[model samples]
Target: MSKVSETTLEIDLRALEHNFRYLKSKLGAETKLLAVVKAFAYGSDMVSVSKKLEGLGVDYFAVAYVKEGVLLRDAGIRTPILVLHPQAVNFDTLIERFLEPSLYSPRILKEFLKVAEAKNQKKYPVHIKFNTGLNRLGFWENDVDWILKHLNGTNAIKIKSIFSHLAASEDENEKDFSLKQIKSFKKSSSELAEKIGYQPIRHMLNTSGILNYTEAQFEMVRSGIGLYGYANDAQIDSELKPVASLKSIISQIHKIEPNESVGYNRAYKSDGYRVIATLPLGHADGIGRHYGGGNTMVLLNGKLVPIIGNVCMDMIMIDVTGADCKEGDEVIIFGGNHSAEDFANSAQTISYEILTAISQRVTRKIKE
Candidate 1:
């Protein structure tokens, strides 16, 4: 409950829990949930976010790299972690930490096997990524035989689960494509399971997939943005709470006259008299330069305050004309009465980018 500093990212734990429950409610008890905690839990603090979800009995946790998993493990998270896009260099660390990698190719699978065999490890869990549609990562459907040839009857890495990503699960225009992805994943998974002589957990649902492709939900589902209170769909978005509230104090207030320029590069020139309030957060803190010179606005006392000039490395200037508040008044970049979507819209970006862009320097205060 106390503020960390002049600027802070207020993470509402209650809202986080609410959002988790809301997403889980959409699925059945049979569906396993893997809470995606990558990118510092969307730049809100993975240690806190993962611990909260772990406390709520989440089935698993996922990260984009081995170090991210190690961070959670070091923080006392005991749940299984699937490294989404693990690199070859971190294989040893991943193995030592028992971090599962999403094996996407024959080469990756072979490399991991060599590491696992040399380490004398057995039955280590590894997820096979199939390129059903998202083509970004994953072994192609035809590579199944090559996968089995390398792993069959070998005392190397064990296949734990198989998954594929949905490219446009949130877009109605891509319904056929999503269905095709599901069908492909299913066929590929079943074929691999038969060849491997057993079934590993099969999952294909990402956040949007869980919402739009319920039938495609296999043995488990990976919910990322939905758990952080975003669904990419207006109907589902209304169901989840906005968990991150970016708030900062108006460190100073100044009165500017006509034709007066503001901030770096002197990009903004006042047409007339205006009140400028400086926020303690800036692009170096994850706001980015795109939000400068009337591109975005911060909310103060329920009124819109347009951002002015080139955003600085440590701060931003907002035209807070006629606002009741002064220096030290609370300024909301996103959250509270103003929504993250609106803030992101003004910046011409998505909620995901805005929420995850907050730099590590911004103190995160967990709201009970």
Candidate 2:
């Protein structure tokens, strides 16, 4: 990999492959792997990430919206794509692109059926999303009867899989709750399979669930953060390599005298002599304002430096006082030893937020 010349997000494809294989080792031999590549592959260039995953032999791909699936299709991704949240308005385009939709509600089911029937789609693949405990977008267990009734005479669409989400698979304190959710999903999916006279693939594990609940591996498993190299657990995180490395070069260096204010609203007032280094990326580049005022620390020349003053729209200043660093020095916002999880922890957030918050404007350099 080349040294950081500017603010760039370096995506290591080898690290992604390592993470994928690591997560796969946790599943049964026959269990399928569905890679979630929504939100620009969690803010690291969705098209590139999806391409690599497809090459890695991922069984399926999942996205949050119809457009995301379309993007994969446009990129020549041939793997089956499941749209996790399909709106009624995009049913036509979704089917047109052969993107599978996760039908979570009666209205959405009916709307998709109408589109499928109108388009003369026979046995168009679709997944049924059940709300085991997430209380999010999914059909209730009671909705099974209604779903069966609606599908009694339809040949336009077919259920490809029945799945649910685990609320707290990463928290040991919530182990009982996770188990109950898993049990509920099993019961509901079994009931639906018996009534529907067919068994669709059953899956209900995310990245954390994959790590903590191997028994509930069902027929398939979905992984998002795990592929990006995070398991929400410190011990597990050590086993996975982060694929995205946020790196920037010091744009400039300044010497602040005593009582000298820096940045907007005079957020940082130097008490004595200090050295501050300005980085090109700021709030607009996905480093939010909340990370300002010394809340977040960045690595400069192998030393951790707190971000001083308010984050500018396109720049941020970090205290580099007494550091053996100069202008053009590389700064690691998060990656390698200090993972995105570590970075987000400093701001009372999670790896998901920081990873996905990275702006698309940041140059993405794929490390093959």
TM-score of each predicted structure versus truth = 0.97, 0.99
State, as a TM-score between 0 and 1, how close model 1 is to the true structure.
Answer: 0.97
Q: Name the regions of candidate 2 deviating beyond 4 angstroms.
A: none
* Candidate 2 structure lDDT: 0.93
Compare the candidates by TM-score and give the number of the best one: 2
Please write out the lDDT profile of model 1 over residues 111-180, one tens digit for every residue: 8889888898878889999998777888998999989888877766788899988899999999999899
Query: What lDDT score belongs to each candidate, Candidate 1 first?
Result: 0.88, 0.93
- Cα lDDT tens digits for candidate 2, 1-368: 46889899999999999999999899999999999999999989899899999999999999999999999999999999999998999999998899999999999999999999999999999999999888988998899999998998999999999999999999999999999999999989999999888899999999999988999999999999999999988898889999999999999999989999999999999989999899999999999988888978898878899998899999999999989998898999999997898889888999999999999899999999
Candidate 1 root-mean-square deviation in Å: 1.3
